[model samples]
Target: MSKKEVETTGHSWDGIEELNNPLPRWWLLVWYACILWGIAYTVAMPAWPGIKSATAGVLGWSTRAEVAEKIASFEEMNAAVNAELAAADVTMIKPGSDVHSYGVNMGAAVFRANCSQCHGSGAAGNFGYPNLLDNDWLWGGTIDEVAYTIQHGVRNETDEARYSEMPKFGADELLTDEEIDQAVAFAMSLSDPEGDGTNLVGGTYDVELAAAGAEVFEYNCASCHGEDGTGDIYQGAPDLTDAIWLYGGDHDTVYDTVFNARFGVMPAWGQRLTQAEVNAAALYVHQLGGGQ
Candidate 1:
């Protein structure tokens, strides 16, 4: 048979004729394959959106289900370690042991998921939040003490919560502004003696003002904070001499702390975390440089 001539559809742009060509067989086949694939995918997997949920396709597979299975597996894997941690005494756990290491690792994960929101990812706290890495602890820094604090929390509604309330000297009219200022000055003298003393002989404080402030402090703050300002752990009174301030250590910060007072609240974790988790977190925190 003679070769057939290709025909033009009679459409022209700038005197250039366009050929009436059918799509290539391979391209047509590929396009059809795509259409079939789309239909198959819609039937075999979740595709259509519904008011509440997507359509559960024939495979019955779901991403949420997969994630749940993964979590269950993880829990199962850690079950033995968690059991050991819960049974062992927090103080008895030997440092550098496998169990201790596991607890620390698990504790870090738990801290990241739960505690990090308030304490920060690095456990370095902000203005109100207490720094976990520091030596200054309002409650106590021992492993058992830390565990107890984690379990019971601080100033929470829970009965076992470590509770203390500093009197609002300014807000409640317990102390005049002058007295509060004097107290602030005295507190600063305790921490920054060099700056607050009159001369090189007397350290950094104004001896007379500090003396007056001392009288005010003795009358109001000494019961909980101690005469030397060393702080009493049982009362949750922070040490004023060390210069580690939860709110701040400056004069203004001291004035605010004395006048308004600070009431930091930590939620009771006993209800939220497992006993093992609480112990593990305590161990992890204890090993973080400042743990007594």
Candidate 2:
């Protein structure tokens, strides 16, 4: 419409007035360009919904194809290393070779992400969690056991997982700390039963307390750890009399043990990794020298 014929309000509220000017030539051209671009884009790209699907795009690009291509390239870059790992057993994935070290490092990363919460940074473990670094093991410390522990886990509630339960001493009110200390000291003493020196914590092993603790032990721990504290491998119980402690052998550590019960669990890795990867980790831990 022409400006001369256009109607406008002479009076305006808040000093604002309506204008009769048409849009600029460049502005109208840009607006039309945008409309054209929209039509072109709808045809050339996957923008609009359709009965079957959106447009395939001028380049025939798709999100699924893009993702698959990226993955293919990534796998291609790692092809040689993956091939080497697939061929090698867990035992062969040592720290020496760059290829083997890569596998070990990768396995360590996996362990840190999944296993470190309980097993600790160095796999040192807590009161209940078994120390991976130590020679002492509830189940056999072979490559099979290590891999099994990683894959099926410990007390993991999985069908094939290893399961065990340490007796709740203080919870059951079976033994007082003083009495438990006596038992702990006695157990520690048995580590070197015929040694010349007296045990550091021998004061705790009073005859009365030992008697009380022994009664408590017989009542609870004996069923799994055994009357002689030799432990039952079938039940995955560690020998209490051994100097090797999964947590620690200190008085405070033992007190913590009796005061608060310990129940450690490992996660099942069978679903997370292939059999080859599981075997690799098993051999890695086993060769760390605690292997049976």
Best candidate, lDDT-wise?
Answer: 1
Model 1 agreement with the true structure over 120-197: per-residue lDDT tens digits: 989998778988998888788999999999999999999999999999999999999888877877876777655545
What is the number of backbone collisions in each predicted candidate, taken in the order shown? Answer: 7, 0
- Candidate 2 — which pairs collide? none
Model 2 ranges off by over 4 Å: 1-106, 125-128, 173-189, 192-208
Task: Please give, for residues 1-292, the per-residue lDDT of candidate 2 as tens digits.
Answer: 7555655657677888776667799999999999999998877877877799886878676899989999899769877786777566554455588766766666775667767787788877776676778777777776656767777987777899988776677778767766676666555554446543233433133344454466656775678778888887768877776666666666567667766667777778887876546655665566556647
What C-alpha lDDT values do all the predictions have?
Answer: 0.86, 0.68
In candidate 1 the C-alpha lDDT for residue 154 amounts to 96
